[model samples]
Target: MTASRARLAGSTALVTGGSDGVGLEIVRMLADAGADVIMPVRNRAKGEAAIERIRETVRDARIVLHDLDLARLDSVDALTAGLREEAAIDICVLNAGVVLLGDRRRHLTADGFELHFQTNFLGHAALIRGILPLLERSRARVVVQTSIAAARARIDWNDLNGARRYSPYRAYAASKLALSLFGLELARRSGRITVNLSHPGVVPGTAIAAPVRALLPQDLVNWAVHRVGNAPATAAQTAFDAATSEADAPVMFAPSGPFGLWGAPVPRAPFRRFLDADAAARVWREVDRLLS
Candidate 1:
């Protein structure tokens, strides 16, 4: 494996969902690269376990864990409130997300929006806004985790909640698409802080997809995902590279192999729909309204 090219000697990073999967890999990479990393996890036990696992490889890795459940707005608020007084984050990776393909039936978060939408898009939006002051203070750049699905996804603005028509794939794709738009819009609005988006391609072994995989045919799941996706560690490189690179705008990064399924990190734009400035503004307004 090629070593990561980015160096972060005096930087501090905040990574969401760093307990497992690609997020975990990013944490390990960031810590290995000499950055002080802060991770917000859903529970203490999992967080501690993750820390232990990382330390096994990085003996002196600087990692701090806090409680954060992105599915709940209150949790997102609580975490940011603490950060405001603690430290200025130099790099923020919004990587926590859920993909529920177990049942196509729609589900709602505590805030009453579609579960995937809230956790993947709305919550991250709130966290970013809440930490905007610190980010600006540090000239921090935001790294948003999107997906290849977003390249083909569309936002049903009229039905943001997926209440009218729902499908797991559609809901997940739409949430990621919304995230891509948020990153693009943030870059357009801010001159001090850079905002970039990355698609990790297909990571078949992610714990995020485990729930859905449980209900599906095991062989079929393995076949379909393994056929096109890389392991979480491999998939994470694109986001890691983008997060630590010198890109100063809203560039989207993805792998550079057959169908963007695997390889080194490369700049790849999403569909024009994701770059719609008006749509991005509309989504930002809607997110603020929802949070309010």
Candidate 2:
């Protein structure tokens, strides 16, 4: 094993969305590094399948699966409650998300929030809050998987739920922006644990890109994605780096390739908009109020 992987031999990691795509790749890397991996998935079968796949390479891989639906606060709470009893959690990768590309209709979760906003941002905020104590105690590295879309998106404070106006891509971008802001703010507020943001670049075959299949010819899009986009394993490097690095402060990692599309992971500055302290604090307060 590489030195970095060897360092993680006795650590524990919690990863979300580990069933497939970039998430599955991240989980495999963690398991291969000898960390005890805990994956909270929305689908049990998929989670089991992911574990089986991981063990194919890391024959003695230690992995546990739990149920979690980011759209439901109750589910998030349940997972958090169980995790709190654990002795140590060295890493937490907030990576699960939903992206609706061509769909025009706005959907709400059972919690009555916009699907993207809830799944991508609010639920993660709640999970972070719920596990704050454990994180603090372990001094864990919390890696938040953000997106390139966040660079151009602006959060509509008035229409956070998309009740006033909505578009699939807009909603997705806004949710990512909110998540970016919250992650930045969390980094500032919590000195006990490290918080890092990772932009995995455009990974084409992943579920997040599935929506775009409806907008264009699937074959053409697939061809383009394969031609220009990074594969799931390649895209997962940014988050993997963030989770394992010993950076003391919050660092944003992204692809070093052109336009931040596909390349090796490197430390990059966050989007100019994400640097707004007031906006980050505002988002933090709003999430707290909503969760309360």
Candidate 3:
């Protein structure tokens, strides 16, 4: 169903990591569709700059900027509280993420948790739970942006926090896997709410590679990605399609293009082990205990 039947127009939508890149593109599309776009970004100044770019494309776009550091639980708490009081959000896109450079041996958050897990997985999960009541009131939909890296690493429940060993790439992959699990679990538990996951292909041109380029020439990575990967706009299209498309099941898995590698956003491959109810429940139970 389109926005009219879904009642998306004039309703509020929230996009985490909406400062730039694919997330910003998603914000623009949602704004054009008549949803008030709420951008929760890590750097307040950069986010405001991004809002300027959106204004160029979307006139009269309702965009709200709020500071949110996914690496810190406290920041998520503040964002959820403020948004809950202000908006009856109709959709939420969990799109913010980070890829640590190889030079960094170990990454840690302000609260001393593993950076990737806390920021990309745990922090977002907590925020989702915090905002569940708002979603319930509005009957909203949520789309979690996962990655192809999720297939490379399975979430080892015992090492979720990465206290045992620290590898940035593995840590990132594990976090995405955990998010995929949470998406499936959330759909099952809520039963009434719409929950889905999408992978935005290997968008080599995205801001994700900018930090690595600061260390080494980014052109090499950019070249390889452009040859076979996706554009940020392509990735954004997948996210937008996955979020707006109605499906029979609550949990929808989509990839950018074909064979789960890259293309437009369409239902691609099933997330490995995601259909395991036992594992999903285990993850949910463990996460619940930690958050509690």
Best by lDDT: 2
Tell me how candidate 1 scores on lDDT.
0.84
Off by over 4 Å in 1: 1-6, 207-227
Candidate 1, 10-117: lDDT as tens digits: 789999989888898899888888888999999889989998998998777899988898889999899998999866789999999988876778989887889999
Give the alpha-carbon lDDT of every model: 0.84, 0.89, 0.78
Model 2: per-residue Cα lDDT at residue 26: 93
Q: How close is candidate 1 to the true structure, as a TM-score?
A: 0.92
> In candidate 2, what are the lDDT values of residues 218-246, reduced to their tens digit?
78996867787788888888988999888
Q: Rank by lDDT, highest first.
A: 2, 1, 3
- Look at candidate 3 and tell me the lDDT of residue 187: 82
Instruction: For candidate 2, report its TM-score.
Output: 0.95
2 versus 3: better TM-score goes to: 2
Q: What TM-score would you give candidate 3 relative to the actual structure?
A: 0.89
lDDT of 3 by residue, 48-154 (tens): 88888988867767898998999888999998888779658778899998777454566778877788888888888998999998887776788889887777676
Candidate 2, residue 151: how far the Cα is off, in Å = 0.5
Best-fitting candidate, measured by TM-score? 2
